[model samples]
Target: MIKALAAKAHTYVVLADGSVPNPTRNAPGALTGKVNTVLGILAWAGTAAGVAGVLITGAMMAISMRRGEGSEHMGRLGMVLGGCVLVATAGPVVTFVFG
Candidate 1:
Protein backbone atom coordinates (compact mmCIF):
# COMPACT_ATOMS: atom_id res chain seq x y z
CA MET A 1 0.00 0.00 0.00
CA ILE A 2 2.80 2.44 0.91
CA LYS A 3 4.62 1.78 -2.38
CA ALA A 4 1.37 2.17 -4.31
CA LEU A 5 0.67 5.58 -2.70
CA ALA A 6 4.20 6.81 -3.37
CA ALA A 7 3.92 5.74 -7.02
CA LYS A 8 0.64 7.57 -7.44
CA ALA A 9 2.13 10.78 -5.92
CA HIS A 10 5.11 10.55 -8.24
CA THR A 11 2.84 10.22 -11.24
CA TYR A 12 0.88 13.31 -10.16
CA VAL A 13 4.11 15.34 -9.77
CA VAL A 14 5.42 14.24 -13.17
CA LEU A 15 2.17 15.29 -14.90
CA ALA A 16 2.55 18.96 -14.01
CA ASP A 17 4.39 21.22 -16.55
CA GLY A 18 7.66 22.72 -15.22
CA SER A 19 7.14 26.20 -16.58
CA VAL A 20 6.89 29.01 -14.04
CA PRO A 21 4.00 31.41 -14.41
CA ASN A 22 4.55 35.16 -14.34
CA PRO A 23 2.89 37.13 -11.50
CA THR A 24 2.44 40.20 -13.67
CA ARG A 25 1.72 38.45 -16.93
CA ASN A 26 -1.50 40.34 -17.47
CA ALA A 27 -1.32 44.04 -18.41
CA PRO A 28 -2.40 46.56 -15.78
CA GLY A 29 -6.03 47.67 -15.91
CA ALA A 30 -7.86 51.03 -15.70
CA LEU A 31 -6.87 51.86 -12.11
CA THR A 32 -3.18 51.54 -12.93
CA GLY A 33 -3.64 53.81 -15.95
CA LYS A 34 -5.28 56.51 -13.82
CA VAL A 35 -2.56 56.28 -11.18
CA ASN A 36 0.19 56.59 -13.78
CA THR A 37 -1.50 59.60 -15.34
CA VAL A 38 -1.82 61.37 -11.97
CA LEU A 39 1.79 60.63 -11.14
CA GLY A 40 2.93 61.99 -14.51
CA ILE A 41 1.00 65.20 -13.93
CA LEU A 42 2.49 65.62 -10.48
CA ALA A 43 5.99 65.10 -11.88
CA TRP A 44 5.42 67.71 -14.58
CA ALA A 45 4.08 70.24 -12.09
CA GLY A 46 7.04 69.71 -9.77
CA THR A 47 9.53 70.20 -12.59
CA ALA A 48 7.83 73.39 -13.73
CA ALA A 49 7.68 74.80 -10.21
CA GLY A 50 11.33 74.00 -9.62
CA VAL A 51 12.39 75.73 -12.85
CA ALA A 52 10.34 78.82 -12.03
CA GLY A 53 11.73 78.94 -8.51
CA VAL A 54 15.29 78.73 -9.79
CA LEU A 55 14.73 81.52 -12.29
CA ILE A 56 13.12 83.81 -9.70
CA THR A 57 15.84 83.11 -7.16
CA GLY A 58 18.56 83.86 -9.70
CA ALA A 59 16.98 87.18 -10.57
CA MET A 60 16.68 88.11 -6.91
CA MET A 61 20.31 87.18 -6.29
CA ALA A 62 21.44 89.33 -9.19
CA ILE A 63 19.46 92.34 -7.99
CA SER A 64 20.69 91.92 -4.40
CA MET A 65 24.31 91.68 -5.56
CA ARG A 66 23.92 94.82 -7.68
CA ARG A 67 22.73 96.72 -4.59
CA GLY A 68 25.69 95.36 -2.56
CA GLU A 69 23.32 93.67 -0.05
CA GLY A 70 25.71 90.80 0.67
CA SER A 71 23.44 89.09 3.21
CA GLU A 72 20.39 89.10 0.90
CA HIS A 73 22.50 87.85 -1.98
CA MET A 74 23.59 84.83 -0.01
CA GLY A 75 19.99 84.06 0.93
CA ARG A 76 18.89 84.25 -2.69
CA LEU A 77 21.78 81.96 -3.68
CA GLY A 78 20.57 79.43 -1.10
CA MET A 79 17.06 79.58 -2.60
CA VAL A 80 18.46 78.92 -6.07
CA LEU A 81 20.41 75.93 -4.79
CA GLY A 82 17.28 74.60 -3.12
CA GLY A 83 15.31 75.00 -6.34
CA CYS A 84 17.96 72.98 -8.20
CA VAL A 85 17.74 70.27 -5.60
CA LEU A 86 13.96 70.20 -6.07
CA VAL A 87 14.33 69.74 -9.82
CA ALA A 88 16.87 66.97 -9.42
CA THR A 89 14.78 65.14 -6.82
CA ALA A 90 11.36 65.46 -8.49
CA GLY A 91 11.50 62.22 -10.44
CA PRO A 92 12.59 60.20 -7.43
CA VAL A 93 9.89 61.80 -5.35
CA VAL A 94 7.21 60.83 -7.86
CA THR A 95 8.52 57.27 -8.04
CA PHE A 96 8.59 57.07 -4.29
CA VAL A 97 5.00 58.22 -4.10
CA PHE A 98 3.57 56.06 -6.91
CA GLY A 99 5.97 53.14 -6.95
Candidate 2:
Protein backbone atom coordinates (compact mmCIF):
# COMPACT_ATOMS: atom_id res chain seq x y z
CA MET A 1 0.00 0.00 0.00
CA ILE A 2 2.79 2.44 0.89
CA LYS A 3 4.62 1.70 -2.32
CA ALA A 4 1.50 2.19 -4.41
CA LEU A 5 0.73 5.51 -2.71
CA ALA A 6 4.28 6.70 -3.20
CA ALA A 7 4.17 5.84 -6.85
CA LYS A 8 0.91 7.78 -7.27
CA ALA A 9 2.21 10.90 -5.58
CA HIS A 10 3.38 13.59 -7.99
CA THR A 11 5.92 16.34 -7.47
CA TYR A 12 6.35 19.16 -9.95
CA VAL A 13 9.71 20.88 -10.06
CA VAL A 14 9.26 22.93 -13.22
CA LEU A 15 6.43 24.13 -15.43
CA ALA A 16 5.88 23.43 -19.15
CA ASP A 17 7.88 26.56 -20.03
CA GLY A 18 10.97 25.15 -18.27
CA SER A 19 10.65 27.67 -15.43
CA VAL A 20 10.68 26.90 -11.74
CA PRO A 21 7.36 27.40 -10.06
CA ASN A 22 7.31 29.62 -7.01
CA PRO A 23 4.43 30.08 -4.62
CA THR A 24 3.09 33.61 -4.21
CA ARG A 25 2.08 35.16 -0.91
CA ASN A 26 -0.30 38.08 -0.78
CA ALA A 27 -3.31 39.52 1.05
CA PRO A 28 -6.68 39.80 -0.65
CA GLY A 29 -6.75 42.41 -3.41
CA ALA A 30 -10.07 44.18 -3.06
CA LEU A 31 -10.70 44.08 0.70
CA THR A 32 -7.11 44.53 1.85
CA GLY A 33 -7.74 48.00 3.29
CA LYS A 34 -10.92 47.00 5.06
CA VAL A 35 -9.32 43.88 6.46
CA ASN A 36 -6.40 45.86 7.84
CA THR A 37 -8.73 48.41 9.38
CA VAL A 38 -10.69 45.68 11.14
CA LEU A 39 -7.53 44.08 12.41
CA GLY A 40 -6.30 47.43 13.77
CA ILE A 41 -9.57 48.01 15.58
CA LEU A 42 -9.46 44.55 17.10
CA ALA A 43 -5.91 45.07 18.29
CA TRP A 44 -6.82 48.35 19.90
CA ALA A 45 -9.80 46.78 21.62
CA GLY A 46 -7.74 43.92 22.94
CA THR A 47 -5.21 46.36 24.41
CA ALA A 48 -7.92 48.42 26.06
CA ALA A 49 -9.54 45.34 27.57
CA GLY A 50 -6.21 44.20 28.90
CA VAL A 51 -5.66 47.56 30.57
CA ALA A 52 -9.09 47.43 32.15
CA GLY A 53 -8.46 43.92 33.41
CA VAL A 54 -5.24 44.97 35.11
CA LEU A 55 -6.79 48.03 36.69
CA ILE A 56 -9.78 46.12 38.01
CA THR A 57 -7.58 43.37 39.35
CA GLY A 58 -5.36 45.89 41.06
CA ALA A 59 -8.29 47.54 42.72
CA MET A 60 -9.61 44.22 43.94
CA MET A 61 -6.21 43.32 45.31
CA ALA A 62 -5.95 46.62 47.17
CA ILE A 63 -9.39 46.23 48.69
CA SER A 64 -8.64 42.72 49.75
CA MET A 65 -5.42 43.81 51.38
CA ARG A 66 -7.16 46.57 53.25
CA ARG A 67 -9.55 44.02 54.73
CA GLY A 68 -6.63 42.02 56.17
CA GLU A 69 -7.57 39.11 53.97
CA GLY A 70 -5.32 36.51 52.43
CA SER A 71 -3.51 37.16 49.16
CA GLU A 72 -6.24 35.58 47.09
CA HIS A 73 -6.38 38.29 44.53
CA MET A 74 -2.84 37.55 43.44
CA GLY A 75 -4.10 34.74 41.27
CA ARG A 76 -6.50 37.06 39.46
CA LEU A 77 -3.73 39.59 39.00
CA GLY A 78 -1.47 36.93 37.55
CA MET A 79 -4.16 35.87 35.12
CA VAL A 80 -4.66 39.46 34.01
CA LEU A 81 -0.92 39.89 33.47
CA GLY A 82 -0.79 36.66 31.48
CA GLY A 83 -3.65 37.84 29.30
CA CYS A 84 -1.83 41.13 28.73
CA VAL A 85 1.28 39.25 27.66
CA LEU A 86 -0.73 37.13 25.24
CA VAL A 87 -2.40 40.21 23.77
CA ALA A 88 0.96 41.91 23.36
CA THR A 89 2.58 38.94 21.65
CA ALA A 90 -0.30 37.74 19.46
CA GLY A 91 0.29 40.08 16.52
CA PRO A 92 4.06 39.62 16.51
CA VAL A 93 3.77 35.87 16.72
CA VAL A 94 1.26 35.69 13.86
CA THR A 95 3.39 37.97 11.72
CA PHE A 96 6.50 35.92 12.41
CA VAL A 97 4.78 32.68 11.51
CA PHE A 98 2.89 33.77 8.38
CA GLY A 99 4.58 36.89 7.05
Best by TM-score: 2
Determine which window of 10 residues in candidate 2 has minimal summed lDDT. Answer: 8-17
Candidate 1 ranges beyond 4 A from true positions: 1-28, 72-99
User: Residue 90: error of model 1 in Å?
Assistant: 5.5
Point out the worst 10-residue segment of candidate 1 by lDDT. Answer: 17-26
Error of 2 at 47 (Å): 0.7
Over 4 Å off, model 2: 1-22
lDDT of 1: 0.74
Q: Tens-digit lDDT track for model 2 on 36-97?
A: 78888989999999999989988888888899888778788888889989989999998897
Report the Cα lDDT for residue 41, model 2. 94
The lDDT values for all models are 0.74, 0.82
lDDT per residue for candidate 1 within 1-77, as digits (tens), equals 99999998976776665654344535569878997799789778877877787777778777878888865556766
Clashing pairs in 2: none
Per-structure clash totals for the candidates = 0, 0
Give Cα distance to truth, residue 54, candidate 1, Å. 0.7
